[model samples]
Target: MRLPRSRRRSETRDVASDKSEATSQTSLPGDQQAAGAARRFLRTALAQWSDSGLPEAARLGERLLDDSTLLVSELVTNAVVHAGTTVELVCRLDTRESPPGLVVEVSDHHPTRALRDDSGVLDESDVPDDSREGGRGLQLVAALSDAWGISYRRDRKTVWCRFDLPAGDGATPLLSLRGEPPAELIAPVPPQADRANDQEWAGRGALSFLAEASDLLAGQLDEDNVASLAAQLLVPRIADWCAVWVYPAGAGARLPSVWHVEERRIDGLRSVLEKSPPAADKRPGARHIAWPATPGDTVGGGALAVPLLVTGRCQGTLLLGRAGPLGLPDEVTGLVEDFARRVALAMGAARQYARQAMISTVLQRGLLPPAVGRIPGIDHAVVYEPLAGDWVGGDFYDLFPAGDGRWCFALGDVCGNGPEAASLAGVARPVLRLLAREGYGVCDVLDRLNKALADEAAAALTGGTAAWEGGQARFLSLLYGEITPYAPERGAHCTLASAGHPLPLVLGSDGRVREAASPQILLGISETAQYTSESFDLSSGDSLLCVTDGVTERRRGQRQFDDDDGLATVFGDCTGLGAAGIAERIRHAVHAYDSAPPADDLAVLVLQAR
Candidate 1:
């Protein structure tokens, strides 16, 4: 029954007493018959190896023979099914180990195709629960092979496996979680005769695998991404398939990611796994049991499910499934646990960031007014924008009636951005409204707000358990104004003060622009500072323009939007534009000043006489 390397080996070597290592290779056409030819080839190899004690092949030849032929059948079937090209299979007795190892390589011409998904259905989408797939062949290979991996050359792709033909049966490869495993695990070493060289190959493959897994998992900042990465990282590389489950107490469990080695069966696998969520295991070693948490597996259930533990908490569970009752080797199970720890850490970090962002969003919503109030007899417009990616920023604006004959408006910018500056702005806006409605003038409101901010800051700095010690802003630039209109068609009486804010500009109907308020010290600087209000007549067809530093300080290399009186020049050009027209024109001009977006928060307001 022996087939030659070229069908030309002498029949003398096939005798029962032959001790030389039996090795042969063959090329089969890319067709369904390839698997049968491969199985027949394995039968002949085992028959010739009957005399040699390569490992325990002589004593346990019958068991090894059955497993090896099945392994060959599965590997060659996959090549014919997916690659659909000529298959080059090599079967050899590699004598580099304690006894010796049987190395089988099944290669095909197609190399770059994606590893087939067995279920074909992926993710959490609905799929038939009992749907079948063409992955059992791989399941058989997974159950039987000691160590296996895929390799690629320019001309073909090869699936290779090594069988440590069981020595003495005293404690075998299908070891307990604490038992020792073989040394050379999937290392890329050439066949040789030195036993010490086999030991050198041990650990390198595992270290490289974990290092690459870390590189991919470390940069992920989202919980779902952590789950997805962890599942995919285990598949094909370590496990035949994997699923990641993240659940919290009092919350519904989520199956975020699933992957399988065969390119087709992803959906069927996901459906089966979904029906039986693994119990939350907080143990040190992987719980070797059926893992869809199901009663039994059609593909011979042997899975390791363990909690993803970090900081004494279980963020999720990771399940790695193999083909047979033989779970992962002892070393690999430890590796899986270590991998779970990193995934747990990443998930925890992502969740923390999400909570902060949500809180910031709610706080930001409370700090700003719902809508700008309408002003009587004054054509007014307001522009407000925050820096991108910031939930809350330093800049704030408001336009509201003070419940009398006068309407008040304010715009301010704190020293810095984020929750701290947002808190300051949040406090200042409500206080200004309260003071103005109580009959305080524009300058009076500024004075009171300045005292409140400085006092609060001082208290926080001097006390333990202070809320704003690390996050408080040191300064705020503000512009406060009050408008009283006599007639709908006439100019209004305006009183305003600038607290280290941009100077308000009045653009005349005659094309002349002039400053309406003078500069003063910023609030939160001095509690004893007295402020003054400037009064000016806003005549018909004249526009008043106000903005924060985000507008005036917008930069283009060495030049700013307001450099060399640039803002004034831009305002002067808007001769007779209405409130909204002037506000939009100036906004456009500021943005056009540079090709890049503004680096700070922007706010603009404009008012024109009827």
Candidate 2:
């Protein structure tokens, strides 16, 4: 990971252009903390380079920034652990040419420990042991950079790498780095002896095909798209026909996609694959199989079957067929197997991601409240918008009949996200409902919820049960209330309590808005948490709006959707709207405020008195 001082400086000088070159250097002690310092230094360098009026840094985009940061950490850590000497780091950006590029060099005073292949280039195999904990730094450099190598002097050694900036015109650029010529300038002519060069040339072409296929696969996460891409990539390149058969959970294999060079053969190939038996081994990996050629078949080659195995389970199979009389060579077959392995890994990851998403969706739905039944003298509407991510958020709302002449409703937000937050919400909602049904007031219900959550947290901390062992200590901000009709006065009596939750807004009949209650401490923090109810009257045409922080805290770049005053103004403008109309208006306004998806979950409940 470390490079020699003299060679590092020489390589930097070779790539550095006086017209538009910027360089930064730092030295770190060879210790565990060097990697962190190196990453920080890289961040500062990138920031300064970006601000120095260099278009190259901007063109490099966020991906390069991430990759370069990772590379620096890996290289610096390798030097700290292996070289055991102070490490010198240098970063340079050159943009005088039509296309720009970057060079990073790490030098350490350890000459005898240089890692290189027989040809003097750094290679993966040069790492002495595969089973060791931390020897993949060079491999990552090779994979991430356009070019990487090592140079040794009598007293020091240097490891250096370079990357070409993506073209400003958006075209893919060649990977040539410093001291390397463009591919067109060094293009090789085909040998006159076609047969002698055929095998070598085909090998190179196959490798290129695999590389392109890997890039395509990496960009997609859908199972059907991946399977179809695999099929299409094989057809007209390595085979005349290709078919992908995927095995669904607890079901037999099914052909998801099939491709052929000739349109007429597509149906026949699909039928053949559909009727084909599982591989003889019935296990994971790749194999060659005899084609079940029909009597009228025009094609002549055999078929190769490669299983898509994930974690030792066969998830699917990839079948490739050739039209030539001769079978593929041993090397070609091995390459096909390698291609199958990559597809398998991608498919497995996609499947796992899909499963987790489904689970999160189901949990979210289960924790959410059901639709409110008809309530006398009241019109109500609620909107819930979850953030756009894999995990379920902790916002929730519910409305149900508390008892005779009263209805209970609650809106709350747990502190975190994902399953843990969802679990806490799940526990809070039903317990609050049960206590309210048993005739507890708003304040009493919240007190009980706090105790339940505190007990759960204590159980989790003590590992008292399997259900609580992996649980997280969670807190919630809640607004709970009950409403009863005043038949004699044509209004409703409302009792509301706030526990560190956003204050509920009341939109008056005359176009004024105000908060319903003052704030209290959040739940699950203290056993002696005291909550008090605030009583208010909802006259004809008056509406009470309750929401979580997701509404008030929604961000679009530097600006939020609305603060408390802004929300009050918005509410006041909806003076004559019904409950559902006003709820829809606010939801639409929040959506329009930020076209980008909200980073947190949002919930709003509105109740208008008749």
What TM-score would every model get versus the actual structure?
0.62, 0.71
Query: Of the candidates shown, which would achieve the greatest TM-score relative to the real structure?
Result: 2
Candidate 1 RMSD to the real structure: 19.0
Q: Write the per-residue lDDT of candidate 2 for residues 365-454, one digit (tens) a residue.
A: 888888778788888999988777747878889998977989888999988777888887888889888999899998888888888777
lDDT of each: 0.71, 0.73
lDDT, candidate 2, residue 127? 51
388 in model 1: Cα distance from truth in Å?
Answer: 2.9
Q: Between which residue pairs do clashes occur in model 2?
A: 2-159, 3-106, 3-107, 3-157, 3-158, 3-159, 4-157, 4-158
Q: Which stretches of candidate 2 lie over 4 Å from their true place?
A: 1-12, 18-208, 279-285, 294-299, 461-472, 557-559
* TM-score of candidate 2 on Cα atoms, chains taken together: 0.71
**Candidate 2 residue 597 C-alpha distance from true site, Å:** 1.9
Per-residue lDDT, model 1, residue 82, is 65
